[model samples]
Target: MTSCDRFLLDQPGGTLNHIRPVPAALFLAASLALTGCSQASSSEASSASEDATTSASAADFPVTIDAANGEVTLDSRPERIVSLSPSATEILFAIGAGDQVIAADEYSTYPAEAPTTDLSAYDPNVEAIAGYEPDLVVIANDTNGIVGALAKLDIPTIVNEAPATVEDGYDGVAALGMATGHVDETAEVVADMRAEVDEGLAAAPQDRLRIYHELDEKLYAASSHSFIGSVYDSLGATNVADAADKQKSGYPQLTEEAVIAADPELIVITDQVSYTADDVANRPGWENVSAVRNGNIVTVDADISSRWGPRLPQLIESIADAMASVKTPVG
Candidate 1:
């Protein structure tokens, strides 16, 4: 199964770009097909209409936002918002814009109250999205010229692509809040996330722990350059995958020998659909590894780990907890 995808695009020459990591062979194919279809971003229309607004200051209406696609102006609060990006959907709801959302993509499954439809995030149908008649359509990754198509129909859309770092994530959250006319709410959310992350970093063990983050069973790993890896880096944890990411693609495929050589102190499994911590421990020669010997294995939620949404605090907490759990810290 695939994990939550990040805002990062595929590396040149067709490398896996999704937040989900897979074997090198699999990554090539998926990445080649995954992000290649994105077309030119639509500039979008300015000045939202009444149907576009729900609950917002009248002064806030006719607001203009500079986004990934282009400059988008909302004349009024967006009462009917169609979210095609799961990350965006989460931010929308977290910033008090959930009530304004009319429909969301299939993968936006965080808030049970969200009106999740069969609309595909991977293969979005412009007609289906437009059918919602939403005044504001928000998308993350564009495919098949979705932005241009929507523009052709005079449907205003905003491209709030994925963030590559925690700060970028915060920016996106703030942007969404402003977009939905919840400026104060977005500011508070960012402040809270910052406080939680800072607190988590403060709680990290003084000794630097070598971390091996298992993206999947195929042994695809995330490097210090990766978004998830950035979290570990902030915690003062060392990423063993940094060595494997020779090209600095952030995502890399590691051989068994590479994993053994790294000999990480903590093994963080991002997804368990293909294998479990026990399965990793049982791998040939893995039992001799420091993490395996010390029973220092942490399995994290794939959804929470992958998306850089409001739940980002939770991921940091999980990693910080793992760091705190290392009883016999390696010298």
Candidate 2:
């Protein structure tokens, strides 16, 4: 039969008007046999693939990941780890992987037990990291030349991208869990954190108070895309800068003129910044700004507020308090 005729004969809903009954039965039996063989082959292949993955997981082969910077794989679990960022260090501890961390950057002060490892000391410090004989290094920031230098030294590094939003933070916890072989523990920690945040939001004031986050004396502020902006949005507070056009690059500077125009009801500053409520109030034209005049300026711990790590719940609470205290209207 022609291809079109064969196709019509094979299809249940197709034109079966021209087929001889005996020939059609024979063709259907052959087709069924071929289909059965194909399905059996596919099932075997799938089973084999699954077996391979299971064997790989059981063997715990040393694997390196280049996407997060050259993180080296070790046979079985890593016995020694070094963290390059405070956030990464915090994650390691949070996931019950703290026992694996042998060293940490000087600033990895949380949990009170991270070994102090100086980034400046490593040969470009890659050799020194080798001297520490670490099985893995967790990098939270890639701005420094460490990522490239570590690759040259054949060291394993895992670079963590900072979580830009609340959901991203939860995902980060899970990623750390998988990387450190502590998935169950990490899930528990994430669930607890999410519950805390949800409760904070539930109890937060209902009014959409205008908020201004001040990062420095020059009025550097977070855009709608920043971590702080995410916190404000979660708490139902209105970030005055949310409407600003510079929402792409994270934090952006707002001119004094613009600040005066926005006239936020609440101003939040980081401890590292020199500006305070009095400073803003004493500014040449800021005296009339409702936030300054009404003393609604609050300073937050820079490390907790700026770092996107385990202390995020505290950051959310601080923002909630600032918003709750807003009792002025900026013109």
Candidate 3:
């Protein structure tokens, strides 16, 4: 089974044995959830199959889709589309649907050309978005309140909830494709992304190393159940944070005591906090940790590492570089 597939199947277990790459079977299972059974059988089954044959055809009219929060349907191709999340904005640009984007949320800064529409000014502004007369609304699942408000206006909206892993990221891309009437282009993009990730993994060293991913200075971290944890799995590293499976949100805080026990060889931090080897070593009881002693603590770009979007390949490579820099004992 591929590492990506294994990651999708792993439950909230606190063991390192479940840390291996995911099998193809698991990848299939994870993907199945993206296309709901009801929609797959009725609307998407025929449309997707037909779309495969006539790949170039666009939707007859502007259509609205709400795949993130739940499945929503639209009548035609939406001419004015508003994206409520940065990830959604990235997906639209990737699938050749950037032209339809009339407005985007505050953080949709990628691709440089995506229209700077301030929905809510910070998050999602249902009223400002409504002002654009968007034929379609692309929202994140977490933006339920805004989605509800837009629904009242009878605007066709597609919601992309948070993707838990890299596969979910691909599914988001495909979902955007269906919404923008560019399924073929979306499929192509996913294929290329999968291939790139595969190549990077193949080139990595065989000795799978132990890693601890620190989300914040508070000792908050991700487990096998989270997408960020899955990314660590893909890069051939074992996540020590997988030991804490109590939190359903995928991120859980670890006691400094628990971290000392796990004693991962490598420590990774996302934020650019002014932390040095001595800072980590001097932590209350973390003085003896191998990662701190060996100066293996590394900080990564939080935006790319945390956000599951089109730049995942870059994130993966950045992680690989960090792993490569770890110092090993001389033979």
Clashes of 1: 10
Q: What ranking of all candidate models by lDDT puts the best one first? A: 1, 3, 2
Candidate 3 lDDT over 281-315, as tens digits, reads: 67887767878877788877765665666777887
Q: Which structure among the candidates has the greatest lDDT? A: 1
Which window of ten consecutive residues has the lowest lDDT sum in model 2? 4-13
Score each candidate by Cα lDDT.
0.72, 0.62, 0.65
- 1-331 in candidate 2: lDDT tens per residue? 2211111110011222112222222222232233341122366554543332222231344432223443334445677887766777887898799999998876677878878757531223666667788777776655457767776766567666665687766655554554566634654566567667877777778987778887666566775687667888888877777566454755677788888888887888766564556676788988888788788888888767766656778888777777777776457
Tens-digit lDDT track for model 1 on 1-331? 2432332321011111111111211212222222342122222211111112222233546656567777677767789999988778888899899999999988788888989999876787999999999899998877778888989988878888766667667667756765677755655666677778888888878778999987767788878877788888888989999988889877788998999888999998856356788888899888778899899988888778767788888899888988889756457
Backbone collision tally, model 2: 7
Global Cα RMSD, each model: 12.3, 18.2, 10.0
TM-score of 3: 0.78
Q: After superposition, how far is residue 162 of candidate 2 from its true place, in Å?
A: 1.4
Per-prediction TM-score to the true structure, in the order listed: 0.80, 0.74, 0.78
